[model samples]
Target: MTEPMTDLPCTARVPADVEAPDRILWGLTARQIAILAAAAAIAYLLWRAIGDRVPLAVTAAVLVPVAGAAAVLALGRRDGLPLDAWLLAAVRYRRRPRLAVPTEPVEPSGWGPVSERRPLPAVLRLPATAIDDDGSIAVPDTGSVALVVATTVNVDLRTGPEQAAIVGAYGRWLNSLTGPVQVVVSTQRVDLSSQATRIADAAHELPHPALADAALDYAAFLDELAEHRDPLGRTVTVACVAPAGARGEAVRRAEHTAASLTAVGCRSAVLDAATATAVVTAAVDPFAPTDASWPRTPPNDPVTAARSS
Candidate 1:
């Protein structure tokens, strides 16, 4: 066997033992390889076209690889390519022309110096709930004390004396109070639907059929009027009486003022139904000189009675 060593095949004699190359001279991705081939063909065509005027060999060698690399770079940028391998390869190729090692050096610490000592920005604290809608701030409740609804009055339109008396009573009522009071005047639209319905029922029961149509027409008219008219039309003037002291003291003072007005022969009540005149008389001695005298003439006009000392 030793004497016939030259007769053996290369693989059989060497036992097929060999280390594979880490990188190939023409190492490239499928796309990169295509781009490089195209660039080489273009360079060859250009050289053939202008070979007589220029050095074709030198020009092809210099420009073909550069054009291929440029095309590859442009394609990589457009398509999100892995740049780490390419970059390492380039760096290795630059460092060692014939051979290259792709291993990166380990830093002394876990991370780089700049990354280890980077400063962080300060954080700001804010309240958990908002102030506007949350209603964290306290607010005072401000509303009217009570509403004084006026009573209805009817005067005899035919009798002049009765009308005058009613007018005089109203004048007295107006002058009796010394505070703000709201006067609400409301005018409501009339609805005749129930009346029309009653009429329709009556017509239906009757022998004649014409009345039923008339009743229905009347009902329709009434409904139309209601829809067009302002049902809740009103003119309300609100009067707010704010007392000077505490609630209890204010009520007492108001009662006293009402009594004083009644002493002048004006019809008034401290709190409804109870007469102020009796209240005033019972509160003070009848023989006391300080007590106000009863008016000789009828205190029908509150303004005149109020003007009297």
Candidate 2:
């Protein structure tokens, strides 16, 4: 019923210049342009070394640049953080050398902290061993369920004492967890599409003429807000992972997590496959919303629907 009066939000609060990707030189990022220059220099050196050997020099010119680029990219991709990121990770690893050691019971497990210098996949490795109808991501490899999505707590508007109590409660829950649990917070554009749909839904259900008219006005305000800018939203995910093999164990953990969050003044629940997919999809590409991937809306009160579902 509150949908029609919803406010649109602006996400990606980084300044325009900071957010804008650097163009190294003439439409090239620093990484790309720098690499190209290095490759050219290496090719020139190879050609000079093979001078007077006509065919050999020409071959060296082509192969040297190709080999240099291929080697760097292969190294970067294999390490999971290409070029710049990999270099940064390498420095951090150097500062703490112990991270280079392989994890115990490793190889096929696909569990535990990612080692310092290993080739990591571009996408996070989900060790997803199975899928539950209720939408839990299961991993039989470690008898764990992964990627369990949960909502965030908004404590900024609360009084200091309330915020402190909520934080303490959440801390206790973390201390109580028996196994590995990963929580991820990503900065994503506000889901204005969903917000707008909700407002429309609430407006339709209103029978009071004055209220409906006011709802319509608010909806128009949202439309105008969207055209200009929307405020940023805070999205939080509490993923329960590395629990026991039993399916019930996963649910138990999730329930505990949800209850703890509720006590801390946050509305929380375990997500099914459909919602989980949307969250992951948005993480990868926030701009693309597929018809099949996004749920169709008829403007229902999300809070009521969440409770009923």
Question: What local lDDT score does residue 170 receive in model 2, on the 0 to 100 scale?
Answer: 77
The models' CA-based lDDT, in order, is: 0.42, 0.62
Question: Model 2: per-residue lDDT, tens digit, 83-195?
Answer: 76677778887765343332333354556565665542232344454456555666657665534445566666766666667767877887799877767776555655556
TM-score for candidate 1, please give it.
0.22
| Candidate 1 steric clashes | 3
The alpha-carbon RMSD values of the candidates against the true structure, listed in the order shown, are 45.2, 17.3
Candidate 1, 1-309: lDDT as tens digits: 366323222121232424432332356556555555777787677776677676867776767676867575634642234343566677886664342233433335655457455333223321111111111111123221222223344442324554455555545655666564445454433334544455666767766667777777777776676567634322221222434333333234345444543443334333321222221332234333221112122112234435666
Give the CA lDDT, 0 to 100, for residue 271 in model 2.
66
Question: Which regions in candidate 1 have their CA more than 4 angstroms from the true location?
Answer: 1-145, 150-158, 186-224, 228-232, 235-240, 244-309
Best by TM-score, which number? 2
Each prediction's TM-score against the native? 0.22, 0.48
